[model samples]
Target chain A: MPSLNHYLLVAGLLFAIGLTGVVLRRNIIVVFMCLELMLSAANLTLIAFSRFYPGANGLPDIHGQMLVFFVVTVAAAEVAVGLAIIVALYRTRQTIYTDELTTLKG
Target chain B: MPLPIFWLFTVIMLFGAAAVVLLRNPVASAMSMVASFVGLAGLFVGMNAYFAGIIQILVYAGAIMVLFIFIIMLLDLNTDKKRTPKMAPILGGLGIVIAFTIQLIGVISTTPDKAMPALDLPASAASFTPGTQIAKNLSANSLPDVHLIGQSLFTEYNLPLQILGVLLLVATIGVVTLSKKQSN
Candidate 1:
């Protein structure tokens, strides 16, 4: 049987990969992919914990699953708006490179 | 055997994730992300949360990813230029070191206690009233009886749900306002 630690290690590695992406990637869409990777990592950790610690009623405390649902919902909303913003930026600037988007610099 | 299966899925997920980051084309990256999500759903099923795993496939691989691909197609981004990271190698190396150090500390701190008793499931196999007509009615549907989830959502977390609804409404309005084209 796989232990909770194994899941945690998986989550940790995923998070690290996401962090590397966020650091190395310049495209906004790829950055969003990294963000999703990070969120999924957290979700995996939560579900593992929920499975390991059943609630008083003996049900796999559905809180973690519920939380994952909400996270997915929010991620949808975020990407919808985020992609729109990126599109608008691309329209105005003609490029999606982060370094080139320096109009906000004081 | 299960360990090998799990390891295979894990390797797939990790490889897909790396492809998502490294692929030159944005569309290919999005597709790899869908592959990763599918691999993740498989892992979830391996963990015995079949419902969540299926939902992960339906919602993530099916809906959210489609939205991503649709936007990518709609935009039809040009690959005119190659972009590189802004940070120096020294800073990037420092960040990696910090991330690995945190992971190392987390792994060390959470040592499993063999003596600590494994978590127990409730003795009553079925929490609901057993084998009644009502029970039969409840279990007949294909949907994971979300009644328990609904009850918890409405009763205990009603306020949060309401807040989330309002937030979604606001975001919808914002998107509409932002995306509308202005007449010259």
Candidate 2:
């Protein structure tokens, strides 16, 4: 059986990878995808913990699963809104590269 | 979960995540994300979260990835040209990631007892009342994972569920308004 720590390690590494992508990648869409990666990593950790710690009924806690459900719903909505924003940004700016989007630079 | 299967899914997920970052083409990156999510769903299943695993595939891999690919195709995005990243940001990002990884390892190591205990399934859980009907499916040998989740969602987390529904509705409206053409 894989230890709880082992799953945590994987989740941590995955999160680190997502963070790296968010920081290093220049394309806006790729960056958004990386953000989703981070969220999934979080979900992984949550499910692992849920399985590791049994609930009062002597089964895996459903609370953590419930949280993951909420996270998924929110992520779906976020992706929809985010993609729409990206489309609108492309329409007005005709560009999606992060470096060129300098309107907010002070 | 078996040891080998755990490692297998881990490798699949991590490799796909790396590809999502390294691939220059938007469509390829999106596809990599789908692979990563599928691997993640496999991991969820290994952890005995059948419902979570199902939704992970259905929501993340299916719906969200489709949206990403559709946007990429609609935009007709060009593959990123071969260009070296600036040394400063590259080093900085790597430094942060490495530091975070080390910190996480330190925390995990300090907790010497981290192995998960064997699953403990009772003959009957209080959450699974007779009224639910699906409660009949629950046995000592089998976990009614879906039934339990549904019961909790309707009872304990009902308020939050309603709130999420409202949030989704608002997000839908927002997307429609945001995507509409500005006639100015």
Candidate 3:
């Protein structure tokens, strides 16, 4: 079995990749996907902690999984709103590249 | 979990994530995200989070990816692929990634809880309510993940669950309003 540290390391690497993409990617949609990657990385870490640390009943911690459930729900809603906003932005601006979205820059 | 399975899924997840970053087409990125989420779901299952794993696949790999692909197709986007990479952002991003990785490695290496719990440790049968399904499952050396999660969500986390429902409602309304054509 892989140790907790191994799981944490993988999660951290995944998070790092997501962060890099968010910074370097020009496409707004790809950036959003990277954001999802980061969120999933967080979920992995949570699940790993929950698994390695047994609860009072000697089972895996239930709260972490519960939180993951809430996170999934929220992420779904976030993606819906975010994609809608992206579509709206594309409709008005005719571009999805972050470099071209300079109207808000002062 | 077996070492090989762990490494396999990790590779799949990371490869898909990298593809999401390097692939120029948005559709390919979305598909790669699905593969990544599927790998994550497998990891969740390996950790004994059956319900979470199943829903991860259903909600993320299935519904979420489909939504992303739909939006991409709807937009008819053929984004510019020729933009020269700016040095500043590239360097800054790499700096952040490297710094974060080093910090994570330092912290994880120093943490005391390096060892995982015994894989076959049974859930204490006495802790659960007698005659309940949870107790029954515990006695059988298996976790009733969905039952316990449902109970916790309805009881201990009831308020937050309600709030989450409201938040989802607000998001739905927001998306509708945002997507609607503006009247001048």
lDDT of 1 by residue, B1-184 (tens): 1678878878888888888877878888888888888878777777656666877788778887887777777777645365554559538755884778586567646787221124333232355676744344345532232555666678887888888898788878877877787466
Model 3 misplaced regions, further than 4 Å = B119-123
Instruction: Tell me each candidate's TM-score.
Output: 0.84, 0.95, 0.96
Q: Candidate 3, residue A25: CA error in Å? A: 0.3
lDDT of 1 at B110: 75
Model 2 residue runs over 4 Å out of place are B122-135
Cα lDDT tens digits, model 3, A31-102, are 999999999999999999899997887888989999999999999999999999999999999989999999
Where in model 1 is the C-alpha error above 4 Å?
B78-80, B83-94, B105-110, B113-122, B131-147
Between candidates 2 and 3, the one scoring higher on TM-score is 3
| Share of reference contacts found in each model | 0.28, 0.85, 0.85
Q: Note the chain A TM-score of all models in turn.
A: 0.95, 0.98, 0.98
